[model samples]
Target: MTEETRNRALIVRGRYDLTVPERALIERGLLLADSLGKKEYACPILNARFVLMPAGTFMMGSPENEPDRCVDETLHQVTISKPFYMQTTEVTQGQWKKVMGGNPSCFKGDDNLPVEQVSWDDVQDFIERLNRQEGTVKYRLPTEAEWEYACRAGSTTAYCFGDDSGGLGEYAWYGDNSEDVTHPVGQKKPNAWGLYDMHGNVWEWVNDRYEDYSSGSVTDPESSSKGSDRVIRGGGWRYYAWSCRSAVRYNGPPDVRVNVLGFRLLSLSSHREIKSEVVTNEQVTSEKLKITSEKLKKLIRLGEEKGFITYDDLNDMLPSDVVSSDQIDDIIMFFIKKNIDIIDPDERETLIVNKPTTGETSRDRDFIAYNNGTVLDTRTNLMWAGEDNKFGINWADAESYCKNYRGGGYSDWRMPTLDELEELYKSENYENVIQITGWFVWASETRGSDAASFYFYDGSRDWYHQSNDSNGRALPVRSAK
Candidate 1:
């Protein structure tokens, strides 16, 4: 037979065990003979299956005698909490190419050999693409917690099989068994969990955002929400056997692709969703006040279609005098308290008059003292000095304005919603200086044809273009504290 066919024949035959039974040989023959239709057997050995691993919890990480133990791997209780099926051997090049479209492995060997030299990101993309073709989301990288738990396989020792590293040759292909190169997978004995090459093959990638471990027990602890690097686990054939210990942890960047990196898949178990408890009104009020204060200070933006107010007449109304830095700081603090509705009535009166040596500045006092005589949209102006102004614009133009328009020399701006605009109104004295003659438009966040606008005149809101034509004239724009 040709060398290529000879290798294929070798794979079909499989390895001999330390002990073999007569019944196993006969059963192999019967299965092959039947499929070959009474002809002499070309390949007598076939149909052998790898053993599957059963799931349970196990202690992860190293004990005191380990070569290099970091504080992050402090012995803490972890639970897998679910069963999953893992490959009996590391994924071979032939199987990888079949599932993924291309082969990027550095070492080229027999089709049955384990693929090597892939990165963590490359593996994730491969899994994502494979799931699309397979029509299932059942495949994913095992989380770091799952990897360690599986590697431990109920063993509390440094190595899953035992504490001594002398007999590693019997179960793994490490620095000694491997001649500075990866051999075909599954050439070694399986672990107690019936998994092969978990200790040494290629360093496998695990799904986790890396973080230091906490001292308490954690059930199925995934990584943190955000991190600079992702976690990788398991040692490779190129490293020392001690490095292949069950509890050893390592990490790498999510985007990195390397020759020594590869991954295995895990399937999630079915579970019920848990709901959180309700929040109190006091908490809600605190949150709403914070949001309101932030919204009030944000510069009002005009949409692209609506443009901005650029009249020289309006610009000329702004005062040329610069407010002292100390006074400006006090004014900002006053406005923040007012927006949060925390200022007392007595404090409010004293603030409006600019009286010196008070506990704190009032919103009305600061508004009149710092911005009372200024214009709204001037580069030289730092604040909008008006209580009531008619600002109107189409919904589309308003969004664009907030996104791009720079006011008070600041670029970050967003259009105010109806509720935000209404916060500026005084209900008790509505018919005097606050009333303006115009059908002005206020911005709303609602999108598409269901878009809405608020009317500043009566504090009433309705969908934009609900009663009027879709095409309307330029809407005025204004800003507030």
Candidate 2:
């Protein structure tokens, strides 16, 4: 009698044998999903179920003939060489509350419903805290290719059920049946691989910046490049069936939170126990060296307390400057080779740099230079351009210059931010610092109609006219991940 009741009645009593298109969809969908059926894993930290996805190569993006396909979804081949575990469903209200200690979902009262209204930035905090609780850096957001690879569950069809949109109701809760609000997760039938809510429920966030797909094949590709917006896949409860297609993509500002956006977790290889090795003290210490040793001890203690350093590898990790040396210097350099892949870029950018030390500072050491013509700042785990651009350029040109940089065996580089430039000031007075003396550097920050620039002379910062009127050098930086 009522509209809502009518929709529910139709859903329950609907009966139709497989159509020609439906049979094709089912066959294709089963290709990927039929094998990875419910390799279930429950995270001890959040107690949510995860499914192990296999490693294989597949076509990524969409074909030109795909109906409603966007121009950016250029078909290409992608190989996911490593297997990872992905959450069977989007993160639910209960899991978010357990890891983040709060539930921000607009659709409340159901603990099993997918959590929404969480921004990509907020998800970073959730991931960091979850890693700490689990005592391993294994959890992360899936890459765009990984997300699509799993969503397809092996099939290349538009909706993962083939090209037919009529049968989408059986596998997803989209606009037609969602009743304008999210329902509980896993209520509908799953895809061929037993993955529920892949087509609908909410827009799932992937760990990639918005970029057009390339035509060439790639192996274990990653998007380390920085951008203003991040990619979100899958459709939401309020979206039409076309938007729920497996190849569909959307992007939003990383800090923007909406009622329809949420994320799932991707678990990397299991944790390994770090083995400690004994190292004999190779450095001969004088009275002055003793004082430097005290400073090093204090720094190490602070690092341990801050959860940045583990005690297991204390001996294995020593100051980089102390390598192959018979004597030590005023500055001590501790090397921490983290699993860069597991760290999120947003969180990496937020890591606090230690203040300059009066007696012996960590910033006094030279960065680890790569054969590819880039330098690594072990202190903050950021890679920087070994040299500045010879000619000063406008802000717009500076951005383009950084993006086009091809040094260091990497392609994902961008101009440093204002705060990041300020952090570079800590390296002042160090002999090995990049020779940008007497020149101002352009930062990726805008002040009104003008851009911000940092003067290397006195470490002063100021705003200047737009790129047309003002000129400065651009120094590119990339995440070590």
Candidate models: Cα lDDT each: 0.49, 0.67
Native-to-model Cα distance after best TM-score fit, residue 336 in candidate 2, in Å: 9.9
Q: Worst lDDT window (10 residues) for model 2?
A: 326-335
lDDT over C-alpha atoms for residue 360 of model 2 = 23
TM-scores for every predicted model: 0.45, 0.51
Q: What stretches of model 2 exceed 4 Å from their correct place?
A: 1-38, 270-481
For each candidate in turn, give its C-alpha RMSD to the true structure in angstroms: 29.4, 22.1
Model 1: how large is the Cα RMSD against the reference?
Answer: 29.4
Tell me, by lDDT, which candidate is best: 2
Off by over 4 Å in 1: 1-55, 269-481
The 10-residue segment with the lowest total lDDT in model 1: 39-48
In model 1, residue pairs whose N, Cα or C atoms come closer than 3 Å (at least 3 residues apart or on different chains), thus clashing, are 117-259, 119-257, 302-401, 303-397, 303-398, 351-365, 352-365, 392-441, 392-475, 392-476
| Model 1, residue 362: C-alpha shift (Å) | 56
lDDT of 2 at 237: 93
lDDT (Cα, tens digit) per residue for candidate 1, span 60-164: 666565666655677777766555545556767755654332356777758566776667767776665344333233457888877777676677877778888
**Model 1 TM-score relative to the real fold:** 0.45
